[model samples]
Target: MNEQGEDTGIVLTEAQKRARRSRSIAIAVSLVALVVLFYVMTLVKGPMMLVRPL
Candidate 1:
């Protein structure tokens, strides 16, 4: 029992930390891949893709 008036004994294992890090890295890589794919698609589509109708 502490300031919160309860036993706040929560801890993460080494394997859990590693898993979290791996998941974070995977998400970052996925986002970067999506950005690259979008850029490539824009280039392949040409300027016509940017044309807006009024």
Candidate 2:
């Protein structure tokens, strides 16, 4: 493996970087929304959600 001036990967263009960042933020927002939804559902369901008939 030659270490001198080794090209690890192609440099991303400004447009590509912006697009990648936008996608990342969108995904993060989606995941956060899902988590909030589940939390809200748990609150709305109350303790009865944990109680099951044996």
Candidate 3:
């Protein structure tokens, strides 16, 4: 019984590690996308667009 419990714990840890890695990758991709979006917006609207306000 104890060995089975240990095996289960190990499996759970591995699964958790994969989930964490996936989440990190997703966050990184999102940040990159956000940066690209901002860059494009700046190019289309001009650099001073933010300073002028609505």
Candidate 4:
């Protein structure tokens, strides 16, 4: 038993584990994409991006 009173909290079922893993992977991918976007925005000169008022 854990301090929180959940004896099998760490023993997730296979399906649960797979779901969690996929969620984690998606989050990591999104973070990486955001970082790359930020880097490109900062590194690329203004002329490379087209801007128009909506």
Best by lDDT: 2
**Which scores higher on lDDT, 1 or 3?**
1
Give the better candidate number (1 or 3) by TM-score. Answer: 1
How accurate locally is residue 6 in candidate 4, as Cα lDDT from 0 to 100?
75
lDDT of 2 at 20: 99
In candidate 4, which residue pairs get closer than 3 Å at backbone N, Cα or C atoms, i.e. clash? none
lDDT of 1 by residue, 1-54 (tens): 569798867666999999999999999999999999989988988896688668
Ranking by lDDT: 2, 1, 4, 3
Question: In model 2, what lDDT does residue 18 have?
Answer: 100
| TM-scores for all predictions | 0.67, 0.74, 0.66, 0.64
Instruction: Report RMSD (Å) for each prediction in the order shown.
Output: 4.9, 4.0, 5.1, 4.5
Q: Please write out the lDDT profile of model 4 over residues 1-54, one tens digit for every residue.
A: 777887764678899999999999999999999999988886784655566557
Arrange candidates by TM-score, descending.
2, 1, 3, 4
> Candidates' lDDT values, in order?
0.89, 0.90, 0.83, 0.85
Off by over 4 Å in 4: 1-6, 45-54
- Stretches off by above 4 angstroms in model 1 are 1-9, 50-54
Candidate 2 local lDDT, 1-37, one digit each (tens): 2378776677789999999999999999999999999
Give the lDDT of residue 17 in candidate 1. Answer: 90
